[model samples]
Target: MSDRKRGSHRRVSTSPWKYVVATWFAGVLAAVGLGAVSPAGAALRSSLGLSTGELAWATSSITAVSAVLGIPAGWWIRRLGAHRALSWGLFVMSVATVAGATAGSWGMLLGSRIAEGVGYLLVFVAGPVVLTRVTRGGIRSAALALWGTCVPMGLAITAAAGGVLASRWTWNRWLALTALGPLIMAGVLTAVLPRLPRAPVQHPYRAVGAWKGALRLGAAYGSLSLVGVAVVMVLPLFLTERREVTPTAAGTLVALVCLGSAVGGLAASWLLRRGLALSSLVPLGALMPVACLPAFSAEFPLAVSGGAATLVLLVDGLLISAVFAAVPAAVSRAEDVDVANGILNQLGSVGMLMGPPVFGVAIAAAGWGAVAAATFVFGGLGTVLLLPGARTSGTGTAHGVARSLDAQDRVDVGEESEPLRKALDVSRPNRNRI
Candidate 1:
């Protein structure tokens, strides 16, 4: 084999962290479109003569596609290869952004957002697979943990940048500018991202035999989304109404708080590097609802509430990282990684779609106090789902995980999946710990 081909086959292909950075960056770019619509809503509505409901759909349409196509997207990514899928996803996002920029009507914009959704899911679902392929041991824990922060990071960036851009250039022109980022990033990844090592190709997928561990983790994620997305989507309005904060200030506060999710992601990795078992971190799941209690309640002072909100967000990030890091340990075979991700993606997508509207209805019926109630139930369910996988050997160091591509070859998971449905085992500890 040629030197290039031979090097691509190395266990640690290229500079793994650079690949992690590239994959994670691509994920963040995909998430921009998810938040792009919400900030641009008023501008788009005025420009296109659309309704509030129409505007809501425009923002959610990307999430809607994820809920519907998430599993299949994973299956396709499995066949397509994670590295190439990311590249294709980026190119697709560029085209979709251009379509939105040129759109003159709600219909046109919605179509563009849907296309972006397709691109978005491809990038999101495929990312972890790539991260796991490139790194091992404790660093693998940290890398996957870091990957979980992409969505919050992207949204935070967009929330801060989107309003400014929309004000300066108008929404469509703003979109035109953001379009170049992915195009540039895609080229950067082609050069900087490592080629994935080869593995046995699984035959055409059968959706029935999802790993039970993944199912529980995915369900936990969905439950967490029920609370987390509600808090995020509703936070600005909550602040504006509850504390009389200005729209811009509330948006800024939220954007900054959202970035705290990264701290949580890194924290999960830190715990693992210190020789913490994945299951022992179960109480860490309390980060969201515990913080939400005060943040969502009127009984607390504004300072206290805001502090709680920040805590919830940071913990949410930590849990998400934990799940992504744990996913490999959740499945028994290395080849199953993408499929397990599909399961998590599918369920998590469901939660993202459901969180906002459901929270809205609950608050309407019971008042702000209801937000705490709903989050408590959802958060408890999420915590419970992560329990089964934490007590095993799989929850330890990466080399200890037995679920590599071929049973004899140990790949790195480096443990820690609780934040993510145990996402980061991704399955039960003893069964497939890698």
Candidate 2:
């Protein structure tokens, strides 16, 4: 290669990763911004005079909207390009989040959430596309892991921080502080994200057509989201209202779940290195909530309940994080990485929609324990869905392998009668980087 070409390549490689980090930072911002509200949902509901169903609708409406909009958002990204789409997403989310602080009515709050949901959908859809296009190999996985981890980490940080601030300051201040997360993301993106390359019109077309795949991935994503929100969203209320735990302690329990999710991401990175099937973790993820059921049901004292809630959430978090990490890896495990990712993300949006309602319904009817039990059922279904199909082990195969396929050996059987070949020329993996 010419010196100029080599230097240019080096610069491109470095530049994309910077954008990847910035985008991942956006996930954290959205997570923190949104998550900060969970601990206060009960209060918000009272302040707004919302019914249980209305509160549930208002609480989960954002995720549901994100799920519904994710595909369209992906299509839009093709026109706007990843960087520009992401910038617009950040700006919109920042404004929406700040506005959420001042919402006095159910309608106003729901509207704010809808806007945030649209932003979340766009940010998530575009973020991965940019990362995949810019970085290769281990960097791809690392970038993804970073993105996956940011959600829980942001939730943990924001929940704890919000609880602390709300205890001392006013709720508006807490909401205003949460807005900072997105504003910072917008600033960073503005500085580092480059001008977007033109997107193809066909991008949305392909994404829309991947309906079957999107359904399957969405089922999986929904299952995961159901369990995650059950723990994160409901548990805080469960502890406070049902268990009579303090807000600080409840926040700590939520933080523990996020902590477990962070660790689970690291563990998943390790498992991926070992060439383990994504399906292997499926059972564990399914079982984590079941494990929580007993703990949640037991009539333990406050200290024990606090410790148990933390422990259960921690385990479930690991499982949930692994589930989150697995979706991208599993989708990428397909030869049609782009389509697979698009579909997977779309499904995740569906999952996000389903999780809150399920949790809220269970909470309203049978209480937190019932919600935990319901999570076990949903998670078990997810495990069954992830059973391995016939595919190469992580080799990027062409056939629609259903089994616990590894990324390296994934086979892609295109829609014609041809032998499997390499689909996307992704970066080669470096096992040592994890």
Q: Give the Cα lDDT of each candidate.
A: 0.74, 0.59
Candidate 1 weakest ten by summed lDDT: 417-426
**Number of the top candidate by lDDT?**
1
Model 2 over residues 1-434: C-alpha lDDT tens digits? 36555444444454445666677788778777657666566677667888888877766776677666655565566666666777787788878877888998888888887888787767777776655545544454455545656666777787677666766765556777777777777778877664533433433333444444334555665676567655666666767776777876666766776676666665655564455554465556545665566446547666665555555544444444444343444442232343444555667657665676677877789765686677668767655554431112234531223122223223333343121111122233323321
lDDT of 2: 0.59
* Best-performing candidate as measured by TM-score: 1
Least accurate 10 contiguous residues by lDDT in model 2: 417-426
RMSD of 1: 7.1
lDDT of 2 at 233: 62
**Per-residue lDDT of 87 in model 2:** 75
In angstroms, give how far residue 264 of model 2 lies from its true place.
1.7
